[model samples]
Target chain A: MGGPGNAKIEVVLVDDDALVTRTLSFLFAGEDAFSVQLFNDPVAALRHLEQHPAHVVVADYLMPGMDGLQFLSKVRELHPESSRIVLTGYADKDAAIRAINEVGLYHFLEKPWRNEELLLVLRRAGERALLLAELARRTEDMAAFREKLFRALL
Target chain B: MTDAPGIPDPCRALFSAHADPAAVLDPARTIREQNAAARASFGEAAGRPCWAVHFGRETPCPPCRAGEVLQEGNALRWMMERADPAGPAAPPGVWEVTLVPVRDAAGRVTHLVELLRDVTLTLGLERHLIELARGLDLEIARRTAEAEQLAGRARELQAAIEQLREEQADLLRTERMAALGRIVAGVAHEIHTPLGAILSSLELVRARLAAGRTDGLNELIDLLQEASERIRKVVQTLRAFSRLDAAPVERVDLREGIESSLALLAHEMHPRVAVERAYGPLPKVRCRPDEVNQVFLNILRNGVQAIRGQGTITVRSFAEGGVAVIEIENTGPEIPEEDRERIFEAGFTTKPRGEGTGWGLAICRRIVREHGGEIEARSAPGRGATFRITLPIEGPL
Candidate 1:
C-alpha cells in the first residue's frame, strides 16, 4: 500500500494457505490508509512482530504446528495493545467461545467471508489499537514528569 | 224316567248306546239315562239333575241351551272356554255343547240329549300359536333397533373421515406458505453476499478506469461472472426444492431429508447457529419425501426461533422399536409445562401474534401422523427443548 503519511495504521495477516492471504491483501492494498503485511508462516510473522510490532494481527484458526488460538495467545502476551482477529473456514461454537474467553479475541469471521464484514471488523480493531497507543504514550509522559518532579525536590 | 217315552223301550236303549258323551234328560231336567262315555266324563250320573251332574250346581245354570231347546222344540249349539277338571297342566280349552230335543211320533218332546265333548287340545294348540306370534313381533322390533344403531355408527364414521380430510388440506396450504417465507429470507441473504462482492469489484474497476488502467479488467470480469453464476444457482436450487408435484410416497433415506432441509437453511442458519449431527444408521422410511422434508424445515425453524442469540442445534437419527426416529435439540428457551400438551393443537401458538401463526408445529405433526408417524416435544422448563418424530418404515396405519 502507498501512503504519503508515515503514521499510517500497520496490520499483519498470517495464514497457512498463501492464496487466501494473497487474495485478501488486495482489499487493504487498494487503500492509502493502511500498511498491510502478509505471511504464510506463523513463526516468521511472530519473529517480525518481535522487532516491529503491528497494531492488528490477523490469523487462521486451523493452521498446522500452531493454531490461531495459540498464536493469538502469544500475541496477547507480546503486545497487549494489538487487537487479534481469527479468520478460518472451520466454524465451531466451542472453539469460538474458547477463543473469546481465553485468548481475548476481537472477532471470529468464518471463511468465504464477505469484504464488508472483514472491513468492518478490521476498522473496529484499528480504532481500539489507536486508543491503546495514545493511552500508553500518556502513561510514559506521566512517568517522565514524575521523575523530573523528584529531581527538583532533591 | 227311562221308560217315560210314548214310543218303545228300544229307542231308549239306542240313545243310551251312543258313543259320544251323551245323556237323556226329561223335561223336568232330570237325567234319564247316560251313555258309557258320558258316565266316564261326568262321574256316572244316572238319576241326578242335569245341572247337578255336569256343573255341580244346586240351581239351573244361566244361559241354558237345553231349556231353550225344550221351549223352542229345536237343537242348539254353544261354545265356551273353561278349565278342564281332568288335566291340571293343560291350558284353558274350548267346549262345543249341543242340546238335542228327542220327540215322539205324536209331535211331543220326549227327552233332551246333552252331548259332552272335550276340545282342550285344539284350544291349547291355538293358544300356543298366538303366543308364538307375539314373540315374533318382539324379535322383529329388536332386530330393527340393532339395524338403526349400525346405520348411526356409519354416519358418524363418515363425518370423522371428512373432518380429517379437511384438516390435511389446511395443513398443506399453511406449510407451503411458511416454506416460501423462509426460502425467501434465505434467498435474500444468499444473494446479498455475491452482490456485495460484485459491488466492491465495480468500485475497483471505476477507480482503475479513472487512473487510465486496464491491466486487471480480465480478473474483474471473471469475478463478476462468478458472482452472477452464484445468483443463478441459488435461484435454481430454490426452484427445485419448492417444486409442487403429486405426492410420491416411497422409501427414502431419512438423512437425505435432513440434509436437504439444512442446505435450504444454510444461508440463514450458518451465521446464527452451529448445527451438530450425531446421525446413526437408520432404515429407509416409507413416506412422501417432500412432505417429510417440509416437516424437517419447520422443526429447524422452531428451534431457531426459540434461541435468543447464538445457539447450538443437535440433530440425531436412529432406528428404535421398528420406527425411524429423528430428534432435534435446541439450546433455546424452554417451553412451559402447560404448553407442551396443546402444542400440536391447531392454531395454538406460543410465539407472538404476527411472528407465528402457530401452524408450523401443528402441520409438522399432521404430516408425520398421516404417514403413520408421531411427533412429540420433550423439554424441561429451562433445560431447552427437543422435538422427536418417529415414523414407521412400512406405511400409514
Candidate 2:
C-alpha cells in the first residue's frame, strides 16, 4: 500500500458557484493523499494551469466566460496528460459527447454529487495519471533506442 | 490507291483511328469500306445498306442528307432527334451527322461520304444544368417564404411591445394612486388618536358645566364636542380611504368592514337613493381590510349613482368554502355586455365627465388584486348591475 505521504495527488477545481467550490474544497481538505485548489473563474484557472499543472482538473458545465467543453479542450492542448472531469446540472448529451470526443474526459458527474463517489473517481484518476506517465517514459526510451539503431546502421 | 476518288487521306485516317462507333456510306444507300470505327459501331451490319446500319431498317431514312449531297454534290451538315428502336440497352442520344458528295472524273456526283458523332454526354450535361437551375429556383422560393414569416413575426412582436407599454402606463398610474392612499391612511391614523382625546375632554367639560347650571357654557361645550366628533368622522373616512393601500394581508371581519364602508359612503348618498343591508354570518378573511372596504364603497357609490329617480341599493355578505362573499346589487339600469369589461378600465365611464372620475372601478380592481381576491360585475341591459367580491377566509379561529 502506498502511503499518503508517498502518493500526493493534486487536483484543480473550477466552477462559477462559490458554495459548490468551497464545499468540494472542504471535502478534499481532510484527505491526506490529495490537495485541492479551487477557482471560481474558469479563465483564471486556465491561466494557473499554464504555470502549474495538476494531476486532474474538475470543472462545471455552464459558466459565463468559457463553457466546460471549451475549457477542457484548452486544458487538453496545454497538458494532454492531465485527467479531466465534468460536473453539470443540465443533462446535455450533445455537450457531453463533444467533450468526450474533443477533450477525452475521464468521467462526468452531475450536480449535488456524493462525496465518497467523487473522491473514488479522483483516486482512480490519479492512478490513471501515474500509468500514463509510465507509458510516456517507456515510449521516449523506445524512440531513443530506435534512433541509436538507425545511427549504428548508417 | 487507284486514285481513291473522293476520300481525303486525313479524313479517312480520322475515321479509322476514332474509337467511337462511326460509319461511311455512299449516296446509293450502300456501305462503303467500313473503317475500324464503323466495324465496332455496327458489328455484323458491315457491307449492309447505310440506312440499315443507322435506322436498323431495310429502307433508307427519310430526308436523308446523303441523298441530298448526291443530288447537289455539296457538303451537307444536319442534326437529328430520334429514339433508338434497338431495345432498352440502346442509349437514346442525339447525333450530328454530316455528308460530303464525292464526284467522278466526268463531274457527276457518285458517292456521298457520311460521318456520325454521338453527343450523349453533352446532352446529359445540359439536362443536369437545367435540373440545377430548377433546384436553385426552389431554394430561392423557400428563402423568400422564410423571410416573409420572419417579417410577420417582427410585426407581431412590435404590436405586443406597444400593448405592453400601454399596460405598463396603467400600472404606473395605479401605483401612484396606491402611494397616495398610503399617505392618507397614515395621516388619518395619526390624527384619529388626538381627535379621540379631544372629543372625550369636551364631553367631560360639557358634563361639568351642565351640572353647575351654566347654560351658555354648556352650549359652547356641546358645540366643541360636536365639532370634535365631526372631525373624528372625517378621520375615520380618511382611514378607510387609506386602507385601499394597506399591506397585502391581515385578519379582517368581513361583515364589520362592509358596514364601515357603507357608513363612509353615506355622505355621497342622494335623497332619491335608499340603502338596504342584508348582512349574513361571515367569517374573518385573510386580506387587506382597507382595500376590501374600498371595493365595497366603489360598487355602492356606482350603484347609487346609476339610478336617475328613486332606487334601492342592497348590500349582502356571507361566507362559503373558506371564503367571504359580498354582493352589492342596485335596482338601476343594467350595463350592456359590450361595456361590462371596459367599465373596470381607468378613464372609462358611462356617466358624464364631471359626475364620474372613472377611476373608481379601476381602483377597486387594483385593491382587490392586492388582497388576492376577485371582484366581478354581472348585468344585462336594463336588468341592473350586481357586483360580487370573494375573499379567502382566514384559518379557523
Candidate 3:
C-alpha cells in the first residue's frame, strides 16, 4: 500500500534468535529494490505487521515465544495475500509436515541455507504474493459493484 | 516173617521194649490181646473193642486205619490224640500210630497190631517256624512303605525348586521389556533437540560464508560443535545401556546405572520437570544389571508422570545397612496415604486406560524382591512422593 512511485518489494523475517534475524536481514539487503523488516520476537512482529502486512514472511521453526509453523499460520490469517516460507533444522519430521499442511507454506527452507537458494525462493514468493493481492482486490471490487447495483435497482 | 506179623513171642518182646503202648486186635477190632505197657496205660483191655479201651467210643473211630489195614492187608500209619494218663481234664498229647495186619498162608488178613508214639516236641518247633516267617513278612512291608514316603517328599522338593526358578525367569523378562520401551522413547526425544539445533546452526553458517562475512564465524562453528556433542552423548549413553541387557549379573556402580537411566529419560522430562541429583559414595552392587536398570526406569518414569508439568525430581543414592539405597522424590501432587501402600501392588493403576500404567510400579517391586532388596513408597497428599529402594550389596539371594 505504499505509493506507486515507491514500488519496492516488502519482506518480513521473524525468529527467536537475534543473530538469525540480523544475518538474514543482511543477506536480503543488497540492491534487490525491496524493503526488509526483522523481528526477534514473533509477537512484536505480528502487532506491527497487522497494520502493514508484508508480501512474504520468513520465520524460524523453534522459538522461545511461538513455533515457526504456528506463527506462519497466524500470518496466513492476518495477511491472506502474503507468501509463507518455513525455516526448520528438522529435529523431527512433523514440524516440516505441519508447516506445509497447517501453515500453508509457500517454500521450505532447510538450515544451512545457501544464498542463491534463499533469494530464488524469495523472488518466487514475491511474484506469488503480488498476484494473490491483485486477485483479492478484484474480488472486493466486484462485491462492492454488486451491492451498489442492487441498491440502484431497488 | 516180619511181614507175616502173627504177633509171635519175639515180636511181642520187641513191641514191649519199644516203650510205647501196644495192642493186638482181630479183624472185628476187639482188643484180643494187650502188652504189659498197654495194660499199664489203659487198665484191662481183653475182650473189648480197641476204640472202647483207647478212645472210649461206641464204635471204631472214623478214618480208622483198622479198615484200611484189613482191606489192604498192609501196614498203615496214622496220627491221633488220646488221654493216656486218665488224670484231671488234661490236654491229650499227639501220637504217631501204626496198624500192622497179619495174614494166613493164603494172604488173608486175620489180625492187626497197633503201636502209638508221642510227637509233641517236633510239632511245637514247626509252629515256632511259621510265626517267625509271618513276622519277617510284616517287617519287609513296613520298610517298603517308609521308602516310598521318602521318595515322594524328594519329588515334592524338586517340583518346588522348579517352580521358583520359573517365576524368577518370568519376572526378569517382563522387567527387561519395560526397560527397552522407556529407553526407545527417551532416545527419540533426546536426539531430536540437538539435531534441530545443529541443522539451524549449519544453515546460518552456510548463508554467512556466501556473503563473505567472516566475523563471528568461530561462534557459529562452536554452536555446531556443541549441538553435535549433545547428540553424541545421547548415543554413548544408549550404547552403554544396551550392553547391560546382555549381562545377567555383574558388579555395577550404582551411580553409573542411575545416571544412565536418567540420561535416557532426560529428553522428555527436561522440558517438563526439573531434576537434581545428590549421589553419595556407594559400593558396587551384584545384581542382574538389566533388571536393576529396569527398577530405576520404572521409578523415574512414575516420578516424571506424577509431575504434571513444572515440577522437580530429586534422585539420591547412598549406602545403608550393607545395602545400596536409591531415593527418587517428586514435587508433584502428593499421593494419598492409602495409595502409598498399594503403589507397588500388581494391577494397580491411577493412570487412565491405554497409558500402560498399572504394571510399572508392580514390576519394580518384583525386580527388587528378586534381587533380595526392598522398595517402599511414602507420601502425604499435596506434599510429594518419594520411592526408597534398598538393595543388598551382596550377590542375588
Candidate 4:
C-alpha cells in the first residue's frame, strides 16, 4: 500500500537473493508511504534508476556483478541526492565504515533484520529526503532573489 | 623648495668622489653623468638613454618602476642588471638604483634624479655559497648510502658464518658416531670368538658331569653354562650395535629390529609393565639395522621411565607410500605441548642431571636424519604420549 493520496516515496531494493528481495518488498508493502521496487541484479537496478530516480536505494553488500559500495558510488555519481542503505549477511565493520565514509551511505542493516527496524530506517531516510528537497528548493529561491537584486542595482 | 631635494646637487659631487662604480640619470631616461669608477666599470656610451647604456637595450623595460615614478610623482628603489663592457663576457652586473623626485618653487614636479651602485660581487658570493651547500648535501647522502650497504654486507656475512658453524657441528657429530661404531665393532668382534669357545667348552663339561652322575657337580656346571650363554648374547647385541656403521645397503625388516631391541631391554623391563607389539606386514625398508634398533631402545627406555606403576608400551610399524612408519606409544602421563618441540633439541632432557646426559635423543635425531627420516612426538595433557618415526625407504642402510 503506497498511500491514499498522490504523494508516494519510491524505494529501490537491490539484492542477489530473490527470497530476501520478496520478503523485504512484502514488509515495505505493509507501509502506506512507501512504493517498493525490487531488483536482484544491481546493473539492471542502476539502469532503471538512470531513467527513473528513486527517493531511497537499499542494496546488498555482496552481489555477483557489483558490490554494495561500488553500486552506491555509481548511484551517487548519477543522482547525488539519492539516500543509500546497505544490507549485508556478514557484519564486516571495516567494510561498512569504508562504505559509509567513501560513498556517503545513509545506514547499514545486518542480516536477520527485523521488519520493524528496516521500516523505521526507511521512514527516517524518507524524511531526510524530504528535508533535502525542501532545502534545495529554498536555495534555488534564494539564488533567484539574489539575481534580481543584483540586476536592479547594477 | 626652490632647490632640488636630497641628492641632485650633493650626489654629483659624491658620485665623482666615490670609489665604487656609480651613475646618475634624470627622470627622462637619460644618463646625466658617470663617475671614473662607472667609466671603468661600463666603458663607452656615458651620455645615452639609461636603458641603452646600462641594459644594452634601445627600449624602456616593461612595467618599469623608473617610468612609474616619473608618471606617479613618487620615489622608487630597485635593483637591475646593467651591461658591463669592461668586464668578462659573463652575464650582466647587478646594480642598486634609487629614484628621487625634484620639486620647483611652486610645488610642481620638475625632474627626477636616479643613482646606481654595482652589487655583482656580493650576488656571485651568495651563489657560490648555495652551490657549496648542495655539494655538502650530496656528500652526506653518499656516505649514508655507503654505510647502509656496509651494514647489509655485514648481516649477510653473519648469516653465512652461522650456517658454516652449524655444518661444522654436524660433521663433528658424524665423526664421533663413526669412531664409536668402529671401536664397539672391534671390541665385540674380538670378544665373540673367545666367548663362543668358552660356551662350547662349558657345554662339554656339563654333558660329561651329567653322564657320570655327579649331582653337585651337575648343578654347578649347569649354572656355568647359563652364565656363558648370557655372555654370548651380550656379545651378539654389542656386535649388532657396532655393525650399524658398515651395514651394506639393503631392504631391512623393521620387525626384526624392534624384536632385537625388545630382547636387548628384556632384563630391564619391570614385571609390572607389559610390552606389546602390534606390527603389520611392513615392506623391507632400506636402513641401518643397528641404528633403527637404537632409536627403538631410546624411546622404549623413555616410556618405561615415564611409568611409575603398571603400564604398557606398544611398538607398531607399517609401510605407507615410499616410507616406513613406526609409532611407539606409552601409557603414561602425556608430555606438555610446549615441551614437545623442545624435547628433540640438543641438551634437553627431563631426567636427573647425572642419570642422563641429554644426548640420547639428540643422537637419535642425528642418526634418523642421516637416513633421511623424521621423528615427531604427539601428546595430550592427561593422555599418554606417542612418538612417530617416518623413514624414506630409498635412504642409505
Tens digits of per-residue lDDT, candidate 4, B1-397, equal: 2222424565567757777655555667666666676666566544587776666676885535876776677888888776554333324778677776666576555566655666688878888888888888899899999999999999999999999889858754774574355334424323332343344334445555668744344444544455466567766765565455455556678777777666555533535458888898688888777677778777877887676667788989888898989999988888988889888886688887644556667777887998999988999876699989999988854
- Please write out the lDDT profile of model 2 over residues A1-154, one tens digit for every residue: 2433366787888976554563454456557878788998888999999998888999877554466788888999998998999975444465577778878999987644656677899888877876776678879989999999999999
TM-score of each: 0.51, 0.44, 0.50, 0.43
Candidate 3 total steric clashes: 3
The candidate, 3 or 4, that scores higher on lDDT is: 3
Instruction: For model 3, state the Cα shift of residue B44 in Å.
Output: 6.5
Candidate 3 lDDT tens digits, B125-192: 77777777777777877888888888899899899989977975675467556556556644654565
Every candidate's lDDT? 0.75, 0.69, 0.74, 0.69
Model 4 TM-score, 2 decimals: 0.43
Cα lDDT of model 1 by residue, B224-243, tens digit: 67777877877765654543
- lDDT string for model 1 (A1-154, tens) is 2222245677898976544564455567676667788887788899899988888999977564466788899989999989999876554565678888988888887666766777778877877887788777879989999999999999
Better of 1 and 4 by lDDT: 1
Candidate 2 stretches greater than 4 Å from native: A1-154, B1-129, B132-136, B139-146, B159-168, B171-218, B244-246, B270-272, B336-348, B357-374, B378-384, B394-397
lDDT of 2 by residue, B213-279 (tens): 4434544454456546656776676665556545656677776666666665553353456788888
Compared with the real two-chain complex, what DockQ does model 1 have? 0.03
Query: Using lDDT as the measure, which candidate wins?
Result: 1
Q: For model 2, state the Cα shift of residue A55 in Å.
A: 99
Candidate 1 fraction of reference contacts recovered: 0.03
Docking class of 1: incorrect
